[model samples]
Target: MPNTPERPRRISVEDQGPMLVEGPVEVTCADGSVAVSDRFVVAVCTCRRSRMYPWCDTSHRRRVKREENTEAEDGPAS
Candidate 1:
Protein backbone atom coordinates (compact mmCIF):
# COMPACT_ATOMS: atom_id res chain seq x y z
CA MET A 1 0.00 0.00 0.00
CA PRO A 2 3.01 2.28 -0.39
CA ASN A 3 1.44 3.71 -3.54
CA THR A 4 -1.95 4.35 -2.08
CA PRO A 5 -2.78 7.97 -2.63
CA GLU A 6 -4.63 9.86 0.03
CA ARG A 7 -8.35 10.36 -0.56
CA PRO A 8 -8.51 8.58 -3.88
CA ARG A 9 -12.08 8.45 -5.17
CA ARG A 10 -11.67 4.86 -6.28
CA ILE A 11 -8.98 2.22 -6.64
CA SER A 12 -9.38 -1.07 -8.41
CA VAL A 13 -7.01 -3.99 -8.81
CA GLU A 14 -6.89 -5.00 -12.44
CA ASP A 15 -6.76 -8.65 -13.35
CA GLN A 16 -3.09 -9.71 -13.19
CA GLY A 17 -1.93 -6.12 -13.65
CA PRO A 18 -1.77 -2.72 -12.07
CA MET A 19 -4.48 -1.25 -9.91
CA LEU A 20 -6.59 1.17 -11.92
CA VAL A 21 -7.00 4.53 -10.22
CA GLU A 22 -9.97 6.70 -10.96
CA GLY A 23 -11.99 9.71 -9.77
CA PRO A 24 -10.82 13.14 -8.62
CA VAL A 25 -7.06 12.85 -8.71
CA GLU A 26 -5.03 15.70 -7.31
CA VAL A 27 -1.45 15.31 -8.42
CA THR A 28 1.31 17.24 -6.70
CA CYS A 29 4.72 17.12 -8.24
CA ALA A 30 8.08 17.86 -6.62
CA ASP A 31 7.84 21.37 -8.06
CA GLY A 32 4.74 21.95 -5.91
CA SER A 33 2.33 22.36 -8.79
CA VAL A 34 -1.03 20.68 -8.30
CA ALA A 35 -3.39 19.21 -10.88
CA VAL A 36 -6.85 18.06 -10.04
CA SER A 37 -8.94 16.02 -12.48
CA ASP A 38 -11.88 13.67 -12.38
CA ARG A 39 -11.67 11.32 -15.28
CA PHE A 40 -10.67 7.85 -16.52
CA VAL A 41 -8.37 5.24 -15.06
CA VAL A 42 -4.72 5.58 -14.11
CA ALA A 43 -2.59 2.49 -13.86
CA VAL A 44 -0.77 2.35 -10.52
CA CYS A 45 2.26 0.13 -10.17
CA THR A 46 1.99 -2.76 -7.70
CA CYS A 47 5.47 -4.17 -8.15
CA ARG A 48 7.11 -1.27 -6.26
CA ARG A 49 9.82 -1.26 -8.89
CA SER A 50 8.47 1.14 -11.46
CA ARG A 51 10.90 3.66 -12.89
CA MET A 52 7.91 5.90 -13.29
CA TYR A 53 7.74 6.02 -9.47
CA PRO A 54 3.99 5.97 -8.87
CA TRP A 55 2.75 4.75 -12.22
CA CYS A 56 2.66 1.36 -13.75
CA ASP A 57 5.41 1.41 -16.34
CA THR A 58 4.79 -2.27 -17.14
CA SER A 59 7.20 -3.43 -14.46
CA HIS A 60 4.58 -5.84 -13.18
CA ARG A 61 4.57 -7.49 -16.56
CA ARG A 62 8.22 -8.25 -16.10
CA ARG A 63 7.48 -9.86 -12.78
CA VAL A 64 4.72 -11.90 -14.34
CA LYS A 65 7.05 -13.03 -17.09
CA ARG A 66 9.71 -14.01 -14.57
CA GLU A 67 7.16 -15.96 -12.58
CA GLU A 68 5.94 -17.71 -15.67
CA ASN A 69 9.47 -18.60 -16.64
CA THR A 70 10.12 -20.02 -13.19
CA GLU A 71 6.97 -22.09 -13.37
CA ALA A 72 7.92 -23.40 -16.77
CA GLU A 73 11.40 -24.23 -15.60
CA ASP A 74 10.08 -26.03 -12.55
CA GLY A 75 7.86 -28.20 -14.75
CA PRO A 76 5.04 -30.42 -13.45
CA ALA A 77 4.99 -32.11 -10.06
CA SER A 78 6.18 -35.71 -10.22
Candidate 2:
Protein backbone atom coordinates (compact mmCIF):
# COMPACT_ATOMS: atom_id res chain seq x y z
CA MET A 1 0.00 0.00 0.00
CA PRO A 2 1.25 3.50 -0.75
CA ASN A 3 1.45 6.03 2.07
CA THR A 4 -0.97 8.92 1.80
CA PRO A 5 -0.95 12.35 3.40
CA GLU A 6 -3.62 13.00 6.01
CA ARG A 7 -6.14 15.68 5.19
CA PRO A 8 -7.03 18.51 7.55
CA ARG A 9 -10.11 17.76 9.64
CA ARG A 10 -10.38 20.65 12.03
CA ILE A 11 -10.78 24.39 12.00
CA SER A 12 -11.02 27.04 14.73
CA VAL A 13 -12.44 30.51 14.43
CA GLU A 14 -11.94 33.61 16.56
CA ASP A 15 -14.56 36.27 17.21
CA GLN A 16 -12.58 39.02 15.52
CA GLY A 17 -9.43 37.33 14.35
CA PRO A 18 -7.83 34.77 12.12
CA MET A 19 -9.18 31.40 11.12
CA LEU A 20 -7.06 28.56 12.42
CA VAL A 21 -6.93 25.48 10.27
CA GLU A 22 -5.03 22.25 10.37
CA GLY A 23 -1.96 22.78 8.22
CA PRO A 24 0.51 21.47 5.72
CA VAL A 25 -1.22 24.11 3.65
CA GLU A 26 -0.08 25.72 0.43
CA VAL A 27 -1.18 29.20 -0.60
CA THR A 28 -0.93 30.46 -4.16
CA CYS A 29 -0.68 34.20 -4.68
CA ALA A 30 -2.10 36.28 -7.50
CA ASP A 31 1.41 37.23 -8.56
CA GLY A 32 2.30 33.63 -9.24
CA SER A 33 3.89 33.23 -5.86
CA VAL A 34 3.34 30.51 -3.33
CA ALA A 35 3.48 30.26 0.45
CA VAL A 36 3.68 26.94 2.18
CA SER A 37 3.17 25.98 5.81
CA ASP A 38 3.83 22.65 7.48
CA ARG A 39 2.72 23.66 10.93
CA PHE A 40 0.24 21.51 12.80
CA VAL A 41 -2.05 24.46 12.77
CA VAL A 42 -2.00 27.60 10.61
CA ALA A 43 -3.51 31.01 11.15
CA VAL A 44 -5.12 32.47 8.02
CA CYS A 45 -5.32 36.25 8.16
CA THR A 46 -8.79 37.71 7.60
CA CYS A 47 -7.92 41.39 8.04
CA ARG A 48 -5.50 41.48 5.13
CA ARG A 49 -3.00 43.38 7.28
CA SER A 50 -0.60 40.62 8.05
CA ARG A 51 3.07 41.37 7.35
CA MET A 52 3.41 37.69 6.63
CA TYR A 53 0.88 37.38 3.86
CA PRO A 54 -1.47 34.37 3.92
CA TRP A 55 -0.67 33.98 7.62
CA CYS A 56 -1.76 35.79 10.73
CA ASP A 57 0.69 37.56 13.02
CA THR A 58 -2.00 38.97 15.31
CA SER A 59 -2.45 42.01 13.10
CA HIS A 60 -6.22 41.56 13.36
CA ARG A 61 -6.24 42.26 17.07
CA ARG A 62 -8.21 45.24 18.31
CA ARG A 63 -6.22 48.21 19.56
CA VAL A 64 -5.85 48.21 23.32
CA LYS A 65 -6.60 51.15 25.59
CA ARG A 66 -2.93 52.06 25.91
CA GLU A 67 -2.48 52.08 22.14
CA GLU A 68 -5.53 54.25 21.68
CA ASN A 69 -4.23 56.65 24.30
CA THR A 70 -0.85 56.93 22.64
CA GLU A 71 -2.39 57.45 19.23
CA ALA A 72 -4.68 60.15 20.58
CA GLU A 73 -1.72 61.98 22.02
CA ASP A 74 0.27 62.06 18.80
CA GLY A 75 -2.44 61.64 16.19
CA PRO A 76 -2.93 64.07 13.31
CA ALA A 77 -6.27 65.13 14.77
CA SER A 78 -4.54 66.55 17.83
Candidate 3:
Protein backbone atom coordinates (compact mmCIF):
# COMPACT_ATOMS: atom_id res chain seq x y z
CA MET A 1 0.00 0.00 0.00
CA PRO A 2 1.13 3.53 -0.77
CA ASN A 3 0.87 6.40 1.72
CA THR A 4 -0.70 9.69 0.62
CA PRO A 5 -0.61 13.14 2.14
CA GLU A 6 -3.48 13.76 4.51
CA ARG A 7 -6.05 16.37 3.52
CA PRO A 8 -6.36 19.48 5.61
CA ARG A 9 -9.29 19.71 8.02
CA ARG A 10 -12.13 22.08 7.28
CA ILE A 11 -13.14 24.86 9.64
CA SER A 12 -16.08 27.21 9.33
CA VAL A 13 -16.34 30.55 11.06
CA GLU A 14 -19.61 32.18 12.01
CA ASP A 15 -19.96 35.92 12.53
CA GLN A 16 -22.03 35.55 15.70
CA GLY A 17 -21.41 32.03 16.83
CA PRO A 18 -18.94 29.23 17.44
CA MET A 19 -16.40 28.16 14.84
CA LEU A 20 -17.18 24.77 13.32
CA VAL A 21 -14.34 22.36 12.76
CA GLU A 22 -14.08 18.85 11.42
CA GLY A 23 -13.48 16.61 14.40
CA PRO A 24 -12.29 13.90 16.40
CA VAL A 25 -10.58 17.00 17.70
CA GLU A 26 -8.29 17.92 20.51
CA VAL A 27 -8.51 21.44 21.92
CA THR A 28 -5.63 22.86 23.94
CA CYS A 29 -6.46 25.59 26.39
CA ALA A 30 -4.30 28.49 27.52
CA ASP A 31 -3.86 26.69 30.84
CA GLY A 32 -2.10 23.83 29.07
CA SER A 33 -5.06 21.52 29.39
CA VAL A 34 -6.74 19.65 26.59
CA ALA A 35 -10.34 18.86 25.69
CA VAL A 36 -11.20 16.16 23.24
CA SER A 37 -14.31 15.49 21.22
CA ASP A 38 -14.98 12.54 18.97
CA ARG A 39 -17.94 14.12 17.22
CA PHE A 40 -17.79 14.46 13.43
CA VAL A 41 -18.10 18.21 13.80
CA VAL A 42 -17.42 20.39 16.82
CA ALA A 43 -18.56 23.85 17.69
CA VAL A 44 -15.70 25.74 19.30
CA CYS A 45 -16.88 28.61 21.43
CA THR A 46 -15.77 32.07 20.31
CA CYS A 47 -17.97 34.26 22.53
CA ARG A 48 -16.32 32.92 25.70
CA ARG A 49 -19.78 32.54 27.23
CA SER A 50 -20.25 28.81 26.92
CA ARG A 51 -20.66 26.92 30.19
CA MET A 52 -19.03 24.00 28.43
CA TYR A 53 -15.89 26.05 27.70
CA PRO A 54 -13.96 24.85 24.58
CA TRP A 55 -17.22 23.35 23.37
CA CYS A 56 -20.26 25.46 22.65
CA ASP A 57 -23.60 24.73 24.38
CA THR A 58 -25.65 27.20 22.36
CA SER A 59 -25.29 29.84 25.06
CA HIS A 60 -24.82 32.57 22.46
CA ARG A 61 -28.40 32.15 21.33
CA ARG A 62 -29.60 32.93 24.84
CA ARG A 63 -28.07 36.42 24.72
CA VAL A 64 -30.86 38.95 24.81
CA LYS A 65 -30.92 42.73 25.01
CA ARG A 66 -31.90 44.19 28.36
CA GLU A 67 -34.04 46.79 26.64
CA GLU A 68 -35.90 44.16 24.64
CA ASN A 69 -36.77 42.23 27.73
CA THR A 70 -37.90 45.35 29.57
CA GLU A 71 -40.07 46.39 26.65
CA ALA A 72 -41.72 43.03 26.48
CA GLU A 73 -42.44 43.06 30.21
CA ASP A 74 -43.82 46.62 30.09
CA GLY A 75 -46.61 45.68 27.68
CA PRO A 76 -45.38 47.97 24.86
CA ALA A 77 -45.22 51.78 24.83
CA SER A 78 -48.05 53.72 23.24
Candidate 4:
Protein backbone atom coordinates (compact mmCIF):
# COMPACT_ATOMS: atom_id res chain seq x y z
CA MET A 1 0.00 0.00 0.00
CA PRO A 2 1.20 3.51 -0.85
CA ASN A 3 1.85 5.85 2.09
CA THR A 4 -0.42 8.87 2.33
CA PRO A 5 0.66 12.35 3.40
CA GLU A 6 -0.54 13.64 6.73
CA ARG A 7 -2.34 16.96 6.93
CA PRO A 8 -0.57 19.79 8.71
CA ARG A 9 -2.14 21.45 11.73
CA ARG A 10 -2.13 25.21 12.10
CA ILE A 11 -2.46 27.32 15.20
CA SER A 12 -2.64 31.12 15.55
CA VAL A 13 -2.09 33.23 18.64
CA GLU A 14 -3.35 36.79 18.99
CA ASP A 15 -2.35 39.45 21.48
CA GLN A 16 -4.69 39.38 24.51
CA GLY A 17 -7.03 36.97 22.82
CA PRO A 18 -7.90 33.32 22.35
CA MET A 19 -5.77 30.90 20.34
CA LEU A 20 -7.10 29.83 16.97
CA VAL A 21 -6.56 26.29 15.82
CA GLU A 22 -7.56 24.55 12.65
CA GLY A 23 -10.45 22.12 13.21
CA PRO A 24 -12.55 19.95 13.41
CA VAL A 25 -11.35 19.42 16.96
CA GLU A 26 -12.29 17.58 20.10
CA VAL A 27 -11.65 18.71 23.68
CA THR A 28 -11.86 16.56 26.78
CA CYS A 29 -12.48 18.28 30.08
CA ALA A 30 -11.02 17.41 33.47
CA ASP A 31 -14.41 16.15 34.57
CA GLY A 32 -14.53 13.65 31.71
CA SER A 33 -16.85 15.88 29.67
CA VAL A 34 -16.10 16.17 25.96
CA ALA A 35 -16.63 19.08 23.59
CA VAL A 36 -16.45 18.80 19.86
CA SER A 37 -16.23 21.54 17.21
CA ASP A 38 -16.57 20.93 13.50
CA ARG A 39 -15.84 24.44 12.25
CA PHE A 40 -12.98 25.08 9.87
CA VAL A 41 -11.42 27.13 12.62
CA VAL A 42 -11.85 27.01 16.38
CA ALA A 43 -10.96 29.44 19.13
CA VAL A 44 -9.67 28.14 22.44
CA CYS A 45 -10.24 30.42 25.43
CA THR A 46 -7.25 31.45 27.50
CA CYS A 47 -8.89 34.03 29.76
CA ARG A 48 -11.22 31.41 31.24
CA ARG A 49 -14.31 33.70 31.22
CA SER A 50 -16.14 32.12 28.31
CA ARG A 51 -19.64 30.81 29.08
CA MET A 52 -18.91 28.06 26.61
CA TYR A 53 -15.88 26.98 28.59
CA PRO A 54 -13.12 25.98 26.14
CA TRP A 55 -14.71 28.03 23.38
CA CYS A 56 -14.16 31.74 22.79
CA ASP A 57 -17.23 34.00 22.92
CA THR A 58 -15.32 37.28 22.42
CA SER A 59 -15.93 38.31 26.03
CA HIS A 60 -12.32 39.38 26.41
CA ARG A 61 -13.02 42.82 24.98
CA ARG A 62 -12.29 45.82 27.19
CA ARG A 63 -15.18 47.23 29.23
CA VAL A 64 -15.99 50.93 28.93
CA LYS A 65 -16.74 52.96 32.05
CA ARG A 66 -19.57 55.51 31.99
CA GLU A 67 -18.70 58.92 33.36
CA GLU A 68 -21.22 60.79 35.52
CA ASN A 69 -22.18 64.33 34.35
CA THR A 70 -21.06 67.14 36.66
CA GLU A 71 -24.32 69.05 36.12
CA ALA A 72 -26.34 66.10 37.38
CA GLU A 73 -24.13 65.76 40.44
CA ASP A 74 -24.46 69.50 41.25
CA GLY A 75 -28.25 69.23 41.27
CA PRO A 76 -30.01 69.88 37.90
CA ALA A 77 -29.18 72.83 35.65
CA SER A 78 -30.60 76.23 36.59
Candidate 5:
Protein backbone atom coordinates (compact mmCIF):
# COMPACT_ATOMS: atom_id res chain seq x y z
CA MET A 1 0.00 0.00 0.00
CA PRO A 2 1.09 3.60 -0.60
CA ASN A 3 0.29 6.84 1.22
CA THR A 4 -2.02 9.33 -0.35
CA PRO A 5 -0.39 12.12 -2.36
CA GLU A 6 -0.27 15.49 -0.68
CA ARG A 7 -2.10 18.28 -2.39
CA PRO A 8 -0.24 21.49 -3.19
CA ARG A 9 -1.51 24.85 -2.05
CA ARG A 10 -1.26 26.38 -5.48
CA ILE A 11 0.50 26.09 -8.81
CA SER A 12 0.41 28.64 -11.58
CA VAL A 13 2.31 29.71 -14.67
CA GLU A 14 3.81 33.19 -14.64
CA ASP A 15 2.68 35.53 -17.40
CA GLN A 16 6.11 35.39 -19.01
CA GLY A 17 8.18 32.83 -17.15
CA PRO A 18 8.37 29.49 -15.44
CA MET A 19 5.64 27.66 -13.66
CA LEU A 20 5.01 28.93 -10.11
CA VAL A 21 4.66 26.10 -7.62
CA GLU A 22 3.70 26.22 -3.97
CA GLY A 23 2.97 23.99 -1.02
CA PRO A 24 4.58 20.73 -0.01
CA VAL A 25 5.99 18.66 -2.83
CA GLU A 26 8.07 15.55 -3.19
CA VAL A 27 10.49 16.40 -5.95
CA THR A 28 12.66 13.77 -7.54
CA CYS A 29 15.51 13.60 -9.99
CA ALA A 30 16.77 11.08 -12.52
CA ASP A 31 19.23 9.85 -9.91
CA GLY A 32 16.41 8.46 -7.80
CA SER A 33 16.78 11.12 -5.10
CA VAL A 34 13.89 12.98 -3.56
CA ALA A 35 13.37 16.21 -1.54
CA VAL A 36 10.51 17.89 0.14
CA SER A 37 10.27 21.65 0.63
CA ASP A 38 7.56 21.09 3.26
CA ARG A 39 7.90 24.80 4.04
CA PHE A 40 4.92 27.09 3.64
CA VAL A 41 4.14 27.81 0.03
CA VAL A 42 7.21 29.39 -1.58
CA ALA A 43 7.42 31.25 -4.86
CA VAL A 44 9.51 28.77 -6.83
CA CYS A 45 11.81 30.50 -9.29
CA THR A 46 10.94 29.52 -12.80
CA CYS A 47 13.26 32.12 -14.25
CA ARG A 48 16.35 30.23 -13.00
CA ARG A 49 18.14 33.13 -11.28
CA SER A 50 18.03 31.97 -7.70
CA ARG A 51 21.19 30.89 -5.89
CA MET A 52 18.82 28.31 -4.53
CA TYR A 53 17.66 26.67 -7.70
CA PRO A 54 13.94 25.78 -7.94
CA TRP A 55 13.10 28.30 -5.25
CA CYS A 56 11.95 31.85 -5.78
CA ASP A 57 14.04 34.69 -4.38
CA THR A 58 12.29 37.42 -6.33
CA SER A 59 15.30 37.48 -8.63
CA HIS A 60 13.20 36.55 -11.62
CA ARG A 61 11.28 39.80 -11.32
CA ARG A 62 14.51 41.73 -11.59
CA ARG A 63 15.66 39.64 -14.56
CA VAL A 64 12.38 40.08 -16.37
CA LYS A 65 12.20 43.79 -15.61
CA ARG A 66 15.50 44.35 -17.35
CA GLU A 67 14.34 43.05 -20.73
CA GLU A 68 15.13 46.37 -22.38
CA ASN A 69 15.77 45.20 -25.94
CA THR A 70 18.24 47.60 -27.54
CA GLU A 71 17.63 46.33 -31.07
CA ALA A 72 13.93 45.62 -31.07
CA GLU A 73 12.64 45.85 -34.60
CA ASP A 74 9.88 48.42 -35.12
CA GLY A 75 6.50 46.82 -34.67
CA PRO A 76 3.20 48.27 -35.95
CA ALA A 77 3.70 51.91 -34.98
CA SER A 78 1.27 53.25 -32.42
Candidate 6:
Protein backbone atom coordinates (compact mmCIF):
# COMPACT_ATOMS: atom_id res chain seq x y z
CA MET A 1 0.00 0.00 0.00
CA PRO A 2 1.07 3.58 -0.68
CA ASN A 3 1.87 5.87 2.23
CA THR A 4 -0.42 8.85 2.76
CA PRO A 5 0.25 12.14 4.49
CA GLU A 6 -1.29 12.66 7.92
CA ARG A 7 -4.30 14.93 8.37
CA PRO A 8 -3.74 18.57 9.24
CA ARG A 9 -3.86 19.49 12.87
CA ARG A 10 -6.79 21.52 14.18
CA ILE A 11 -6.22 24.68 16.17
CA SER A 12 -9.01 26.57 17.93
CA VAL A 13 -8.58 30.33 18.31
CA GLU A 14 -10.48 32.89 20.33
CA ASP A 15 -10.61 36.67 20.43
CA GLN A 16 -9.32 36.92 24.01
CA GLY A 17 -7.89 33.56 24.93
CA PRO A 18 -5.20 31.04 24.22
CA MET A 19 -5.25 29.00 21.00
CA LEU A 20 -6.17 25.39 21.54
CA VAL A 21 -4.12 22.97 19.47
CA GLU A 22 -3.86 19.24 19.13
CA GLY A 23 -0.61 17.69 20.28
CA PRO A 24 2.11 16.69 20.26
CA VAL A 25 3.18 19.95 18.69
CA GLU A 26 6.46 21.66 17.86
CA VAL A 27 6.18 25.42 18.02
CA THR A 28 8.87 27.67 16.64
CA CYS A 29 8.94 30.91 18.58
CA ALA A 30 9.73 34.42 17.36
CA ASP A 31 13.22 34.14 18.88
CA GLY A 32 14.08 31.12 16.78
CA SER A 33 13.45 28.81 19.72
CA VAL A 34 11.17 25.81 19.69
CA ALA A 35 8.56 24.78 22.25
CA VAL A 36 7.45 21.18 22.31
CA SER A 37 4.50 19.48 23.95
CA ASP A 38 3.66 15.83 24.30
CA ARG A 39 0.17 16.17 25.66
CA PHE A 40 -3.01 15.30 23.81
CA VAL A 41 -4.00 18.94 23.72
CA VAL A 42 -2.27 22.24 24.48
CA ALA A 43 -3.21 25.88 24.95
CA VAL A 44 -0.80 28.30 23.31
CA CYS A 45 -0.61 31.64 25.04
CA THR A 46 -1.77 34.72 23.12
CA CYS A 47 -1.75 37.38 25.83
CA ARG A 48 2.03 37.25 26.35
CA ARG A 49 1.52 37.21 30.12
CA SER A 50 2.15 33.58 30.72
CA ARG A 51 5.03 32.61 33.03
CA MET A 52 5.24 29.63 30.76
CA TYR A 53 5.48 31.34 27.40
CA PRO A 54 3.98 29.51 24.43
CA TRP A 55 1.69 27.81 26.92
CA CYS A 56 -1.33 28.87 28.99
CA ASP A 57 -1.01 28.90 32.79
CA THR A 58 -4.45 30.48 33.36
CA SER A 59 -2.76 33.79 34.20
CA HIS A 60 -5.15 35.61 31.88
CA ARG A 61 -8.11 34.56 34.00
CA ARG A 62 -6.62 35.81 37.28
CA ARG A 63 -5.12 38.98 35.86
CA VAL A 64 -8.21 40.08 33.96
CA LYS A 65 -10.50 39.29 36.84
CA ARG A 66 -8.32 41.25 39.24
CA GLU A 67 -8.22 44.24 36.93
CA GLU A 68 -11.97 44.18 36.47
CA ASN A 69 -12.53 44.08 40.23
CA THR A 70 -10.16 46.96 40.74
CA GLU A 71 -11.94 49.07 38.16
CA ALA A 72 -15.30 48.28 39.66
CA GLU A 73 -14.14 49.41 43.08
CA ASP A 74 -12.57 52.60 41.74
CA GLY A 75 -15.54 53.42 39.48
CA PRO A 76 -15.35 55.68 36.43
CA ALA A 77 -13.38 58.92 36.68
CA SER A 78 -15.35 62.15 36.23
lDDT of 4 by residue, 1-78 (tens): 222359677889999999998888787877998888889999998898889889999888788999989987899877
Question: How close is every model to the real structure, measured as TM-score?
Answer: 0.45, 0.65, 0.72, 0.71, 0.49, 0.70
C-alpha lDDT (0 to 100) for residue 45 of candidate 1? 65
Candidate 3 clash figure, as a count: 0
The prediction achieving the highest lDDT against the true structure is 3
**Candidate 6 C-alpha lDDT tens digits along 1-78:** 221358778899976889998888888899999998889889999999899998998767754433356556888767
The C-alpha stretches of model 5 lying farther than 4 A from their native spots are 1-9, 29-33, 63-78
Please provide, for model 2 over 16-40, each residue's C-alpha lDDT reduced to its tens digit, 9 standing for 90 to 100.
8998977767777779898888898
After superposition, the stretches of candidate 4 with alpha carbons farther than 4 Å from their true spots are 1-5, 66-78
Q: Tens digit of lDDT per residue, candidate 1, span 1-78?
A: 233556546778877688777744666656787645455777766766778755677876643433356556888767
TM-score winner between 2 and 5, please give it: 2
Misplaced by over 4 Å in model 2 are 1-8, 67-78
Better of 2 and 4 by TM-score: 4
Shift of residue 5 alpha carbon in model 2, Å? 8.0
TM-score of 5: 0.49
TM-score of 3: 0.72
If the candidates were sorted by their TM-score against the true structure, best first, what order would they fall in? Answer: 3, 4, 6, 2, 5, 1
Candidate 3, 14-62: lDDT as tens digits = 9889999888788989999999888999999998899999999988886
Question: How well is each residue in 8-71 modelled by candidate 5, as lDDT tens digits?
Answer: 2577877755555565666564477765676655556666687765666666664345666555
Off by over 4 Å in 1: 1-8, 27-39, 63-78
Better of 2 and 6 by lDDT: 6
Clash pairs (backbone) in predicted model 4? none
Give residue 64's lDDT in candidate 6 (0 to 100).
40
lDDT of each: 0.65, 0.78, 0.86, 0.85, 0.60, 0.83
